[model samples]
Target: MGFFPDLPITTERLTLRPFTRGDVDAVLDYRGREDVALYLFDAPLSREECALAVQQRILQTSWSEEGDKIVLAAVLSESDTLIGELSLIWRSEDARQGEIGWIFHPDHHGRGYATEAAGALFDLGFQGADLHRIFARCDARNGSSWRLMERLGMRREAHFREHALFKGGWDEEFVYAVLRREWRNGG
Candidate 1:
């Protein structure tokens, strides 16, 4: 059941592991949706090139001095199909603080896959990575993301008005962060 026998993290319903070149079509298929891409990223990525870029990023993590980035493919635990992606990008200067992001296929959106994957990753961050804080940023307009953050027990720390530039204009963001102490305290 270990799709990533070499990697140090896995979950009952997911596998968080290094990306591969073969993931091009699936990654592109998810990234291709305008609704999924607009609020999440600045631009749409070209399928093959972007997949290669993602692969290169994971490869570079092997040599990273502080292990600031982890890009994981969220595969189904049962079938091992790559359903989506989850990531933790640490800010090296912040000790153990990191930010997380996730995306699933539109068909899988409301089925609690995000919550399951994130909860598993949060534990992986706290216990496996020894991270102190892991957070997620969601657009204020994205009610689904906001609700997901709450369901995951992440408290809203800040709401930035026009926090990011998207498609030549400004957009607001809700920043949610959870600390090690809070997680330990059952927050």
Candidate 2:
């Protein structure tokens, strides 16, 4: 057996659980928007693509080995509306390192939902999985994402300058990381 948090992890305002087949439409609400996909690896998904993505996400609920991940749907606890998604990818089992990322509905911005959801993931990674370190990366131009990482108590570790070509242009990247000690110390 490997590290896998029990499903339906709850925070103050959101529930993080495995994606269900019925979640396609809700996922498409944000994933289908151009602005939402601006910093993501993939472009805005179509309805069909969202369905496929949800299907893929449904099977990615466990992190049992290196390269495995837990992809969770972030739903409103009050309304049960799917507003976003969170992921924790196991990058190196030997090093006990993980990578985290998030995407939320544009309409749901500014309410700290991303931070709440990501905090839960941090707990799972650090407390549940016993990971030594967790990191997040975002496009340098994505202020909101890096800011959210900061709010999660992550420190900026690196700033890569135009290292990779993305969306037909040079893409600068920012990497942020937190250690288990820092997270457990309430950071």
Candidate 3:
């Protein structure tokens, strides 16, 4: 249950860490790629732009209290290379629930990194942060990420049509949830 508060979070082959000023280059390198930002809320960002965004996020997470948000950078444990990012946001006024999401470099896709990091964040959000539930919503067209949600034992609770506008017109999406009572890990 021990986590690297601001340094890094380690998995067998990955390390979930916090953002650093030095991370500007990596953030710029990957974030600027169209494929990486395709599903994200924003368009491709330059390194300078992402650095500002990263700093803002860092400030928010660093100053958060018990019932606030948590964002982690997924890095390669061995080399500590930042590969992706994950987040847990407590949207409930009482901080009883959270919403989780992630974005990984396309080069790092299909390696199970997103799912592994997501599960770890879920554990932290619930067991560590004492949240009652953690859920995620994404465009239905994002089948890969949605599949990861299912793999993490979340159940699809809702599907909204034309709920958002992406690169073009409207988009439909699904919501998935997992309650604290329903979470289980392999022994």
TM-score of each: 0.85, 0.97, 0.88
lDDT of 2 at 56: 95
Model 1 backbone overlap count = 0
Q: Is candidate 1 or candidate 2 better by TM-score?
A: 2
**Candidate closest to the true structure, highest lDDT:** 2
Q: Candidates ranked by lDDT, best first?
A: 2, 3, 1
Ten residues in sequence with the least summed lDDT for candidate 1 = 1-10
lDDT of 2 by residue, 1-187 (tens): 4775788899998999999999999998999999999999999999999999999999998877789989999999999999999999999988989999999999999999999899999999888888899999999999999999998899999999989999999999999999998995943
C-alpha lDDT (0 to 100) for residue 156 of candidate 3:
99
Ten-residue region with minimum lDDT total, candidate 3 = 1-10
* Per-residue C-alpha lDDT of model 3 across residues 1-187, encoded as one tens digit per residue: 1222444556678877777787888888788999777777889998779989789657545315444556778888877788888888766736477789888888888888898899888777666766688889988888888999999999999999987777898988899999987888421
* Ranked by TM-score, top first: 2, 3, 1
Per-residue alpha-carbon lDDT of model 1 for 11-71, expressed as tens digits? 7667767788787787887777787786776466777656676776566333144544667
Candidates in order have lDDT scores of 0.74, 0.93, 0.78
- Candidate 3 C-alpha error for residue 113, in Å: 1.0
Regions of candidate 1 where Cα sits further than 4 Å from its true position: 1-8, 60-63, 184-187
